[model samples]
Target: MAYQQPALPYADNALEPHISAKTIGFHYGKHHAAYVNNYNNLVAGTPFDSMSIEEVICATAGDAQKIGVFNNGAQAWNHSFYWNCLSANGGGKPSGELAAKIDGDFGSFDKFVEELKAAAATQFGSGWAWLVLDNGTLKVVKTGNAQTPLTSGQTPLLCVDVWEHAYYLDYQNRRPDYVAATIENLLNWTFAEENYQSAK
Candidate 1:
């Protein structure tokens, strides 16, 4: 069966100003859709065609012959998670367990933001910055190209896509500005908490 593009949980304009409707339109409708289509084409009639997205990801991971499949499947999953990680009313500060975890791991919430911002800003070329749970500890990590935390033995709790396509529609060359705004105004703490709890 062909993979389907997952619909956004909210309207394209829902995360506006910080992340515009225009941005989501292209990012989700074009970029993400392309990956899903490409993945379907890549897997058609193959033995791996019947595998779930996660199964394909793990099975074909690191296999040179399957690089195309890995890229498409990982990007499809990453983009879906990335879109859900944003909301118009999101960002400010996390509370409860998420807050305490940030404080415990990074000293303070502000410091955690600073580190996350830096990671997003400094990810050379197209990639993503993630707040991941590795062995029950939270950490900030960056993955280049279609790489994801799943391939690294880390469970992703939250993520911000630093790919040019993710921010160019809004911030253009100022990728750092987009990252900062996302951290301040678009991060979905509830989604992060849910992912954290599930990973544990």
Candidate 2:
């Protein structure tokens, strides 16, 4: 089956001032849609054409000859997950088991925030910062370009896309500001909690 871009969990303007509707229009309607289109095109009539997105990502992850397939497939999957990582009512600290895991893994929720913010800010180029389960422990990880934890055996609970296109129009050169707003005002902890429980 061909890959299709998933609809946003909320309306285009739901994220409001934290993320502009204009940004969502371009980001989701254009950029993400392009990735899905590109992936479908790249995989059509090939062995990957019949595989799931995760299967394609893992299969093509380190093959230099398949970089296009990996990049597009991963980006398509990543953006789909990233949208669910935001919510109109998101942000602040998570609660319950996921919250307890954060404290246990990173010392405190504040420290986890500090680490996640640092990972997102210091990623250096287009990429993502993620909260993931690695060997049953929660860890903060950053991946460059279309790289994702799925290719590395980790279960991604949540992610922030730090690609320039993700925030360029909204915050211009202030990537840090964009990252902070996303972490503080837009992260969907409920989504993260669901992922955490499923992974466990």
Candidate 3:
């Protein structure tokens, strides 16, 4: 089956002020769509064609001969996950079990934010910052290029795309501002909580 780009959870303009519709138009409509198209084209007649995106990612990851497959498949999956990680009504501290886990694991929600922001800001190039479950503990991690936690045996609970196209049109070169705004005004805690619960 051909891989398809998933629909954005909200309308293109929904995340306005913090994230412009123009950015989503290019990032999701163009870049992410390109990855999905590339992945489908690359695997159309291969054994990987029948695999799910995650399966393709795992099968091709770190295999030099399958780098194209890995990069496109992983980026496709990553962008889909990234869109869901944002919300028009998101942001603020989480409540319930996820909140308790964050506090317990990071010492406090504030500290968790610090770690996540640091990870997102310090990622040296095109990559992602993630809040993942590693051995039942919540942790912040960053992956360069098309790398993802799925390849590292970790379950990603949330992610923020730090690739320039993700924020450049709106924030210019101020990546940290974009990262902070996303965390403060757009992160979908409900989605993270659901991911955390499902993993457990």
Relative to the unseen true structure, what is the C-alpha lDDT of residue 86 in candidate 3, on a scale of 0 to 100?
99
| Alpha-carbon runs more than 4 Å astray in model 1 | none
- lDDT, each prediction: 0.91, 0.95, 0.96
- Model 2 has how many clashing residue pairs? 0
- Clashes by residue pair, model 2: none
**Tens digit of lDDT per residue, candidate 1, span 77-135?**
99989988988779988888989999999999999899899999999999999999999
Give the candidate number with the greatest lDDT.
3
- lDDT string for model 2 (66-115, tens) is 99999999999999999999999999999999999999999999999999
lDDT of 3 at 193: 93
TM-score of each: 0.97, 0.99, 0.99
Task: Provide the clashing-pair count of each candidate structure.
Answer: 0, 0, 0
Instruction: Let me know the TM-score candidate 1 reaches against the reference structure.
Output: 0.97
lDDT of 2 at 108: 100
Candidate 2: what lDDT? Answer: 0.95
Error of 3 at 112 (Å): 0.3
Clashing pairs in 1: none
lDDT of 2 at 132: 99
